[model samples]
Target: MKKYCAYVLLGLAVISNAALAKEAPLVSIPTHDAFFNAIKAHCGKAFQGKVSKDNVGNTFGNAKLVMHVRKCTDSEIQIPFHVGDDASRTWILAKTGAGLMLKHDHRNEDGSFHSSTMYGGHTVDEGFPQVQSFPADVYSKALFIESGIAASTDNVWQMMIYPSRFSYRLIRPAREVQVDFDLENPIATPSAPWGYE
Candidate 1:
């Protein structure tokens, strides 16, 4: 019967489509896992850094910078980015089932969270082992709007981990900032970042 043959053909098409779907890989698995592992290799180590690029002003042009890969867990890494005597910033990288999350932890001298703290982005697609990009997430957008820094809502932050250098970068339409650290020659570890001690 022609009707029976049509049903059989439809079933075959459906089965083939399901097979194709199974063959396609999810966007955020293997690549992000490698990146996470590469960064984890430097756990508990602190590295000194310097500003390599900044178009917003001279905020970090002449400051002594440091980044401590201080605390590490199976799912998250806490790195304190210190500029001169200001230990008010910490960068958090977290691995989630969906993708990676990047957060900024800002604190006061007395270890209190600032009004603009914990604002950051999340990785939406596959990224290479040496580089990962994060676009502003919901929380960051909301915080920026509330704090009157709404321009940051479209910010894209990047991190680069290489054999001898690690860099943190920020990119937006009209602003860009980058900081590079010498991984092969780390200086003496500084005091614990604010809010950690």
Candidate 2:
């Protein structure tokens, strides 16, 4: 009877070990998001510009945004300088049945709040501008305020493109802000011209 009990316990332990070995690693995805794989899929370069607004209830500025995509892994991108101050890493976590997204932990310098309507769209097909409308993967209202630099997202992230690069501007919604940069030939080393972070 003692020998039989020992065999049963051994079998149970082996089964438990096997189960644990077969588990997959955890993938992080925030509950709410703002942008998706919009710029990456459409624009083949990093966005290095700014979006600002001005008088008469109108606002606009030079918008510089840089996003890169890494295959089979999370993105390591630099928004550079979106708001007023150094750049902050906004984690756009990986998701299933969807693409890249922006993590919503809104905090900036001076303890102020900034909320914007975020949308993500990409050019799935390449032929002409009148080919087909891009599918907006995700959208959200995001607020980025003041927080310590070390308090950013603590997870692996990915950009929207492989070797990502492009720049654009909102220039106050309902208008197209100009983007000026070398889409074909980007600098050998990525740079933060606006000096965000």
Candidate 3:
């Protein structure tokens, strides 16, 4: 088992709040398909409310999760290569009969890649960590408290993914706050980031 290191975020604040409360393109209703990178372009200005925390304090603050879609001979996936000051993590995406899912190729602080699938499933609980399946591994209950989004009662599922490694705890689908971050890069990614041969 290869141990992949983890990633962390940098800072927060600054930049007008204009794009703060924006919302990413809603996950289109899908059931099964190849990977797509154009969705990565969706990284621009979007997200509703502010990000608060994720995976303890591993991935928070202002960071962008820039990603692009690519296809392989046997599979299609999304490669989200996040650049942060402390840590960075990547994600691989695929579509199944259930919906869009990440492969769970994350690394541990001790530098060990995931032994099993951290992502990929329909109802989330199907996977090991569970608590996900909606927006991939971006917002898992384990990830939320792990990163630093433990401030409010908002769950990690309502977090945003770009312009800043931030997550939001939705109070009423209208009220939220930017999340936190860890201190490691390449922390985890079900799939893989770009340029990882």
Please provide TM-scores, in order, for all candidate models, with all chains considered together. 0.83, 0.34, 0.34
Cα misplacement distance, residue 18 of candidate 3 (Å): 56
Better TM-score candidate (1, 3)? 1
Off by over 4 Å in 1: 1-28
Which 10-residue span in candidate 2 carries the lowest summed lDDT?
149-158
> Candidate 3, 86: how far from true, in Å?
5.3
TM-score of 2: 0.34
- Candidate 3, residues 16-134, lDDT tens digits: the string is 45468665443433222211333343322222222343334434455543332333322334344344422234455554534445543555444465443253223343322112334
Largest lDDT belongs to which candidate? 1
Candidate 3 lDDT (Cα, 0 to 1)? 0.36
The residue-by-residue lDDT of candidate 2 on 89-131, one tens digit each, is 2323343233333332333443333343223333233312212
Q: Which wins on lDDT, candidate 1 or candidate 3?
A: 1
Quantify all predictions' global Cα lDDT against the true fold. 0.87, 0.34, 0.36
Candidate 1 minimal-lDDT segment of 10 residues: 21-30
Better of 2 and 3 by TM-score: 3
Please tell me which predicted candidate would have the highest TM-score against the true structure.
Answer: 1
User: Where does candidate 3 stray beyond 4 Å?
Assistant: 1-59, 62-65, 68-75, 85-88, 108-111, 114-195
